[model samples]
Target: MNITKYVLVLLVMPFLFGCNSDDYQYPDKYLPNYNFSIDIDMSLPLYTPLQFTANPVYIDQAGIGINGIIVMNTGGGYVAYEASCPNQNLDSCSKLAVDGIMAICPCDEAEYNLFNGQAEGKEYPLKPYRIQVTSGTSIRVYN
Candidate 1:
């Protein structure tokens, strides 16, 4: 009886704690796959109060396996994020709207802090992309 119990425990331990690829699935189309630099004009005001849109001003960072957007924060800082919603894996609703210092998802109302990409109401945070600012004019974003 003791040996049978030990065997059962050993067999179940892997399933309970071991890493499994099945438990994780990357986003199909929304996966970031680009890395490039873009020159942002900081002379004009790009963001409105409590609202920002990346389509008009900023440019997409492109590469072999990464896609991301670079935005000039309302407070004159820059922030970049993976174009996928952390709560839901939908591509259409993945864009985040700036609300003060938080990035709010229009889908499930999940809010992420732009400063650190931490979700405001939930435990899961937004997946952050790598950002490098050079000479205070250009920003390079990567996966």
Candidate 2:
């Protein structure tokens, strides 16, 4: 009986932990180029008192690679993050809503601090981009 049990374990172990030779390859066609920039009009303010909305705005004349970007103003300064959700990597249901001092995603309720881009409820934070604000009429977002 012990010998039969040993044989059964041996047979099941390999099948349970089998290895595949096919290397995991991410489709290159779907991956967008990482480096890019966009220009957002600074005149339009989405939120009030705190002054600016967490929702992403589409800027057509910014540049290639980055047609639309999310701009967040946390009162202290402006923060920019990728429009894509970190949890599911989907662009459709991902958006930032100002909750006190943090940004909350409506889809999964994944919250992030707009001040630092730190995820509140989940481990993974929202992907942040580089923001350059001038004293003029526009802000530049880069990744």
User: Using alpha carbons, what is the TM-score of model 2?
Assistant: 0.50
- Could you estimate the TM-score for every candidate? 0.50, 0.50
Q: Candidate 2 residues 1-143, lDDT tens each?
A: 99999999999999767856433232333224467876666665642222454543433334433224456666567776554455654466654555565656777887776567677566555566667775556777776
Per-residue lDDT of candidate 1, residues 1-143 (tens digit)? 99999999999998889877544543444344444544444434552321342322324435422324535443445566654566666567766666655667788888776666777576456655555665544444444
lDDT for residue 87 in candidate 2, whole number 0-100: 60
What is the lDDT, from 0 to 100, of the residue 60 in candidate 1?
A: 40
Residue range with the least summed lDDT across 10 consecutive positions in model 2: 22-31
